[model samples]
Target: MADRLDYGEGTDAQQFVFLLPEYLKDTSKKMKTGLMFVKLVNPCSGEGALYLFSMCLQQLFEIKLFKEKHHSWFINQSVQSGGLLYFATPIDPLFLLLHYLIKADKEGKFQPLDQVVVDDMFPNCILLLKLPELEKLLQHVTEEKEIDKKKYYKYSREKTLKWLGKKVNQTMAALKTSNINVGARVQSNAFFSSHQISSDKEEDYICYAHGLISDYIPKELNDDLSKYLKLPEPSASLPKPPSKVAAQRQKRNK
Candidate 1:
């Protein structure tokens, strides 16, 4: 006779155990039952796979419960009128299930109970399971044993040095052309001035001097001077040329 079957809530809505049929326990009738019992007791190998499978089953069963509720209310209406039903949205859970299944299969646990529960809940659940492409990419990275630290450091250092050199060259070139008195004597005179220049006037004088020097210096000479200093390239790009319209207006006035 079939074993008396009883289903009750476990710790959570998803947690439940099924009492085996009496025939399943009869070792002479089925050797598969013994194998299944052993697997149930020792699930470490396929734990991840089973966990994911169970989650999917719970989600799918929840969807089925909603479908049943809808059916009860809309008995007169068509099943299609119940609206669309999704076991899990956001796609993450489905992907996780697929990942675990792949791992389980790789580990050689083909008939995991979690997988069984998922299959029982939705016969077409395999259709929903998708291969995680990102997981495949991650696996490739994880499987690689060797890392080229020296090559990485070499490239990083080269890039950093190139950037720093460019900035320093520019700064030195600006300092060379500036009227800020780099010479010790001039700097001392400026610092100990009995009649100091006003801040506004000093700024105006610096700007005017810089403009004059910039106008007088040839492009080639400026480049050579900058190269000699071995400083970083300038932070500021050269100013744009005067507009053709402005130039034409100046020529007309002349």
Candidate 2:
């Protein structure tokens, strides 16, 4: 797959290699318009980011680009530049909805989900409300009040923190199960840590898990989660996750 192209005439046209959930392929066979890509507000950064919305499945997937230097793909006797790969992974819709809910909280009033999730920048955010069990998911992060058979919701920081804590715990458990050495202070651009920590160091697992979770949450929320999880104080000098480190390196190259 990494073979460099050296043969015949190659077009300057760009080629993208994508990795998507296998289920989407079957869904595509029946309907085409149901699956599409859109730019939506990134919950963590509030910036425009690519997302795949499945109107058929009422699901959302996060889109990420993977690229590296000195890499090429030989495709049907043509060379493709940039050696870029795109990934589409399924994501929880609530994480994206939480961004708007927290913002709407500034008003400190219970409102319908429709009003709370509106985004002028990325109007497609409304599609989130269409996801199944939104009411159930919202219950995890918001306080709901039913009046005259209609439900209204308001963001509850207490509940959100608790939910985030559960997420941290889940991530920590996965890290330990996978034997990841997130406790080490060494920096390397690989998934495996260069330095190893004892498996018994539970704190390391928590801190490492927090760092991974930090990628999905805002800085302020991440700080709050750090305190919630009772991990060590965060320091900027610490090494970031391999994916984040690679992204920073790519940004610098650009």
lDDT of 2: 0.69
- Count of clashes, each model: 11, 0
For model 1, the local distance difference test gives 0.29
Best by TM-score: 2
Candidate 1's displacement at residue 139, Å, is: 5.1
TM-score of each: 0.16, 0.76
For candidate 1, write residues 1-254 as lDDT tens digits: 11211123463333222222343356653342221211111012222222112323323211111222332111222223332222211122322233333334444433422352254433434433332343332232122122443110011223323332444445335434432222222321122222243222332233322322332233433344345434344423322223223322233244
**Each prediction's Cα lDDT score?**
0.29, 0.69
Q: Write the per-residue lDDT of candidate 2 for residues 102-176, one digit (tens) a residue.
A: 899999999988889898889988888888888989988999998998899999889999998888899877666
Q: Total backbone clashes of model 2?
A: 0
Candidate 2 ranges beyond 4 A from true positions: 1-33, 70-82, 185-188, 193-200, 235-238, 244-254
Task: Give residue 14's error in model 2 in angstroms.
Answer: 26
